[model samples]
Target: MTRRVEFQLIEKEITRIDSLVSRGETELSWKSDGVLEYMVELGELVEGLWRRIKSAQMNVGKIKAALDAWTRTPLIARKDRRKDALLSFDERPEKVSRRYGEVERAAEQIHSLLEENKLLFQVGDGMEEPWQRYVAYVDGIVMESLRRAVGCSLGEWMLDVFCYDYC
Candidate 1:
């Protein structure tokens, strides 16, 4: 089974075990044998959960490393061209389109990775509110970056249009 499925199963088992223990403590005799067995099973399940958490953490670290690498690589390489040289009209649109495509693809990949491995990001009490907020924050940043890229591209296009028409 996938790690996600395994985690779900383990979580269900832990919840069940907790209810059983609570019932046993409140309703059953102190010397009941069933309580001892449930305690042992609970211990085993806890250990399994711990191991899975560690594995998930490692996977999250690797994903973060990949994201870091992607961020470090420039979407458009500006080193080869002269700083003061303006791109020709024919080249400008193509370069802007290509850069926008690259940014979109990178953003999609980041979103997918986060979506597929969401369980890895959960901390402490496994509340969904925090996770939702984190996702929203990431999405907001991605959208803002895309907005800036498009704005800059439009600005350049406007400048080129004016230069061609009036300069």
Candidate 2:
């Protein structure tokens, strides 16, 4: 999911698709099949989000459990002197998890959008030359938005656990 790797995926797959098109080796049926495969991946992500949404009520407990795990992390070493500074909540329990309520709301918004757009995306992806269709253009835009939201959510979760330095 790193920036460097994303387009490699697009490049590898899209090149094959574009090649088939250029060689006039692809028929309408193949285009439809490719679109279906793409939608299926998108659908799985949406489904995972839906399941997470359904389990939102337990997230606080999960977060707490994960936070507790930090103390037991082997990375913290037996002779580690950095322990106090690392675990100190004295500076305040960081801003990332502090805003969990809003984050949950935002996640819910994405879940709602997925529910509303699920069928639309399927239909849109199935359209003629959908890879070049106008509706497909919008789907790409929405996919970007979804990627942003997903990145934000996971980033915040990582920050909350001090898995990486906070911004």
The top-ranked prediction according to lDDT is 1
RMSD of every candidate to native, in Å, equals 8.7, 17.1
Count: clashes, candidate 2: 0
Collision pairs in model 2: none
Q: Per-residue CA lDDT of candidate 1, range 3-105, in tens?
A: 4433443465568668876876787775776777767776786666676666655555554553454344333433354333343455556766865676566
TM-score of every candidate relative to the true structure: 0.40, 0.23
Query: Residue 11 of model 1: what lDDT?
Result: 62
For candidate 1, the TM-score is 0.40
Shift in Å, residue 6, candidate 1: 21
Q: Model 2 compared with the native: what TM-score?
A: 0.23
